[model samples]
Target: MLYLCIVNQTASQNAEEFGFHAGDIVQQWLWDDDVDDSICTKIEDLTGEDLVDEDYGTAVDGVVIWWRDGDDEDTLADTIVDATTMLEDNGPVWVLAPKPGRPGAASSSTVQSAAKTAGMNAATPLTVSKDWNGIRLRAFGKGR
Candidate 1:
């Protein structure tokens, strides 16, 4: 008798570097004009998750929200609330904004304040792409 085994080895080894895991549902919100396809592809490939572009109001594992510095704080807070509301329990929200030297770049402190106003805790920043930086935030308790 002959024995045969099947194995899958194409999985990315750096998925965790981007804070992603297999089967995670990532929703991307575009508030800026620049979009990097390479970065998007890498995210999907590494995480093995579906990168959705629409806001369906359903629970998601994570959210990638891109915005500019000029965006109004009130509006940004509102948007963050809405976005975090749709996330699953313990799901993270990544707020991506322009880098410091880029046009319409928002300071990290400003982003942190906005997240706080939205009832979310802003974590340290990360590089999302060549032109954008991201800050991870988590929603407050259910009541908030």
Candidate 2:
């Protein structure tokens, strides 16, 4: 899949592209200083709820994961599998990683490989932010 799929898009546009819905209990994984606040805030605006991180104790309707190049495929694959434990079936799992030229950036192929290893289907990379790219993962042969 191509990188930077969305260009000159508003923060709200980026959030909408994330596929979130009203009343969706979204969990944000691996929150860090690098995560884009504009996008995150827009997500909240759309969902009308604050995003729950891994520290939260509850099931989620969807998940947003921030990943980096240093985060190995195996560990990430495991994280993807574990993320399913608290997610509703067919819920979306979004993996956001640094784009090329950014520090600690991971390639789209790596994310795709991890998703496959975790038994999920990886969608094309989306330009979520200036420094990051994202992909949506779903149960194998499920969310086409």
Candidate 3:
């Protein structure tokens, strides 16, 4: 498992890094144009299910929030909370943001602070793409 966590890994090689499972119904929060497309495709491929963003008519297995610096405002907590409406019990909320030194990157402290405010615990982060890093936020007592 540790060997699979290296940076610059292919989409499939990094699937476990995001904890995706087969048939998972992952809800997409906000998709900025700058978001990495390969990661999304890999998720769909690995799960054999398309990511759902509209209607949210069913309980979702997990959520992916494409975040940026501006998204870390007071609403960050609100957004995180809102994203949890239909989440599975102990479901994860992945906050993907630009890496440090990149435009619109949210600081690690800021991301963790918002997660705390939203009543979630930010877990070990993963490299989502060359320019993006992701933090897996879990409800207390919910994740590894």
lDDT tens per residue, model 3, 46-113: 88999998368899988898889876456778888888988886666899989989999888788889
Model 3 worst lDDT window (10 residues): 5-14
Query: Model 2: what TM-score?
Result: 0.87
Note the Cα lDDT for every prediction shown: 0.72, 0.84, 0.82
Candidate 3: segments with Cα more than 4 A from true spot: 1-14
Q: Which ten residues in a row have the lowest lDDT in candidate 1?
A: 1-10
> For model 2, how does the per-residue alpha-carbon lDDT over 1-144 read when each residue is reduced to its tens digit?
233544534433738778788878889888899888877887888889989988778888889989999887899999898888899867878999988999989988999999999998899888887888889998877847
Across residues 30-144, which tens digit of lDDT does each residue of candidate 1 receive? Answer: 6444765655677787668768874566678877787788888777788888777777866767888888899878888888898899988887877766777878887665331
Using lDDT as the yardstick, the better of models 2 and 3 is 2
State which candidate has the highest lDDT: 2
| Candidate 1 segments exceeding 4 Å error | 1-15, 140-144
- Give the per-residue Cα lDDT of candidate 1 at 14: 42
TM-score for all models, in order of appearance: 0.78, 0.87, 0.86
Residue 119 of model 1 has an lDDT of 83
What's the alpha carbon RMSD for model 3?
3.1
